[model samples]
Target: MLPSTYLPSVNRLAPPSDPSLEERYGSLHIRLLYHFEHDFYHHTKSLHPGLKDMLALFMNVGFATPYLMDELLAYSAAHKSILGQQTSQLYLSEATRLQTRALTLYNSASPQISKDTCLPMFLFSSLLSQHVIYNVSSNVHNGLGPILDGLTNSTIIHRGLVAIAKASWPMFSEQVQQQLIRSCQRDYMPIPSSADSRGECEVLLSRLNATDMKPESIAVLRSAVENLQDRFDAICTDSSHAMWAAVQDWLVAIPAGYLELLNQRRPEALVVLSHFAVLLYRVAEQWFVGDLGIRLIRLINSHLGPAWEDWLEWPNRATMEQL
Candidate 1:
């Protein structure tokens, strides 16, 4: 298992002359970086055309930090692995090794969140999250145990960013913050809130409301569901590729106690998550998410047994609509 992802800022500044990717990381990474820029990056854009702006902002954070470059190269290799390229195992091994190297480079430094470092750090963490989710989602044949473990790892990665962001929000460049943050908050503007208007979420919310859990736990689950409602209402309707942000929020901004329940695979939390998986069903062909939506809902249905079919009914039908 990989170490908990850490988005550390270097205590020391980069050298007087910023080194280029080929110059610093050498030829093997140079080719991967080439594939990422010329091929993989644009392919993602084509897949999620509406997300062009958000992705442009994401990719603008550069190889200034070697770990960020390492992440890019690793994800590039992972792309080849996912596609079942020649020597797919070699690509997978490279992807795994490079990501580990990225984490080590991050941890080796003191984490000082200067303005200069904020966006790069955010992108670093985000790329890390994508690769984790993509890697796990791609390999779902490994079974639910590892998928759950990967889900835990992905959550830990995003939560680490949330912690870092909370501590360093002021240091982040105000100019570019809205470009990303507003995409995340698009639902915040004058949207309908009553559960009746949120038809997709009506059952999920009602179930949370009827539950016998503690008020704190109840509040946490409700918060996750409600935020999920925001995402479903706004992003899912457009079939936006910005689902990356939804996945990120699902991991990071989820109500604190909700994650504990999810970690325990509480019926309530998993049911809410199953609903979200229906949303994921839209992008199933996207390599990053793979067929996770179908797989996750099926796994949850089986895991929860027959008694909970009432709760899973809508999610199951929704995915069938995709079929």
Candidate 2:
């Protein structure tokens, strides 16, 4: 349990003065800086045994904030002194690698480009990976159904629904496709007890029967259902890596709807979507990496925007002692 007192202050650490560090390190340096400041290193150690490795790999990418780095290094030194030498050496090596690659990639880009191209891909990959980890874990806990219920009411869900509607090809089996149409027709319902029970799918069907669904909405529902089904199928079939891959695909798909909701200035939708993102990220990291789940944790903390710093603060001493 972290203390509540430790708010995530703005990253006050200056970038390395050396222009070479900037050229060589690229966005990876920023990532490392962001993560380290958020105390990912400490959190990774606290995760369940199953999630540690994935967390470590995330950390290895060296995305951290300066404040987080100070805490991480201090925590590591105080509690795991013997591992300090090895950890420091590893951090330095990875940082050096990132810097060199960043410089090379930047130099090759056209002068007209204003931003680092690699940054988007790297960030996307990291976020996608984390989202996958979270989805798998939530599914295992039976949490996704409720989360989806929340999303169904969201404006973003509307956009996603619209996207699905616009697709030219059918994305799901006829039966499933119809079921989704019905589900979105009425007020959303809870998940059924079993395949035979009256589940959300059944509620959807009831809604459709009550009203004529817009052909466009039908198309949108069809697309969303199909996309979801494909992911579900992958999860069911691929025993070795299905979990990771399916979750990644799902996260990648989220921004389409998410951005739409954001554009509409729907705060409730944003809250739900953000929760979905955080939950998915946590579960994904837990399932794939075990104890080292902190990497994604840190990434999420940073990406949640400025407010997360305050959220990451340490608890009072009494509260800490109680834990």
Candidate 3:
């Protein structure tokens, strides 16, 4: 891993001291960025947390520095090979930070911040696109295989689906949108070796399709779903509770309007809606167990239906009894 204290080289933006200096440093930087992003994409779970922080810092610099932006664009245009490399670096280095920054920048009132921040925001969107396509095309079996296995229980399956749907919908780039729809069109193979796991995967996929369709932007919805599907599948297959939680949080963050749309058009939004409903049911169930559960049940029942009541009776009810 690169030293946490490492700063961009002193000569980072210096005019080529020599003709080759520009070519050499530029090439090296681009290549380094590529490997860094590749590692993040393929080995994020295994990566050191400190390294992840460092990468996030670099990504901050990329977005925060005007000089770096100019250089990145110029380098990308001059050396097409370097484009993906630079993008990967910016993405893998501090992806979550960049994402947070993009949202902040988007919400900021300053024109300068908004204009300058769009590049990084766009870059982040691009990274999402790449992940969506890769997961849809190559990792489906390992990713979705296990999640489908556990879907036999309507509640689990429903929550899983909602999680997937929520992950896949909302504001995103056009490229990602198209890729998601294309991925869904592909044949789905069951995990013959793990019946329980495969059932979960199917439920998750179904739910993903549900919420994904709620976004007014069909293009954005498609791409987001593709990416969500991959992540959702991985969660079930790996039994990654933390990852699953992250997905659930993202789903919960969606606007109420979108969720309402899904509810209204449940047939078209079955995949995402069922998944979201199930997730809500689980959270409500959790609330019911702690001293807070009664209040939560009342709060949910005020707006939702008997689904919550049914969930309270599930055999897995004890799983959420503690809160």
TM-score of each: 0.78, 0.30, 0.28
lDDT of candidate model 2 versus the reference: 0.34
Tell me how far the alpha carbon of residue 183 in candidate 2 is from the true structure, in angstroms, after superposition: 38
Q: How does each model score on lDDT?
A: 0.69, 0.34, 0.34
Q: What digit string (tens of lDDT, one per residue) describes model 2 on residues 1-323?
A: 11111111112111232334343334544545455434454655443232344344334433442222322232222222223576655554453333233323323332221132222223222332232232232233333333333233232223322332334115444653454344323222332234434121333333334445455444444343344334444333323234434444454454444444434533323333332343233343343333222232333344455653333332111122222
Tens digit of per-residue lDDT, candidate 1, span 170-219: 77667666666654443223445565355777787898788799998888
Model 1 segments beyond 4 Å from truth? 1-27, 47-63, 162-190, 211-216, 321-323
Steric overlap count per candidate: 0, 53, 39
Relative to the true structure, candidate 3 has a C-alpha RMSD (angstroms) of 17.8
Error of 2 at 66 (Å): 25
Worst 10 residues of 2 by lDDT: 4-13
23, model 2: CA deviation in Å?
9.0
What's the CA error at residue 169 for candidate 3, in Å? 20
Q: Write one digit per residue (lDDT tens) for candidate 3, span 1-323.
A: 11111111212211122222123235545554565545443444332324344344445656564333333333222222223675554533333232223323333322222333443433333333222222122222343222222111122223333433444345434654454444333222332343334232344444345554444544333333444444334343322233435344344344434444343533323334333333333333121111222233333343345554443332124324533
Model 1: per-residue Cα lDDT at residue 58: 54
Give candidate 2 misplaced runs (Cα > 4 Å).
Answer: 1-18, 21-107, 110-226, 237-240, 252-258, 263-323
- Residue 98 of model 2 has an lDDT of 38
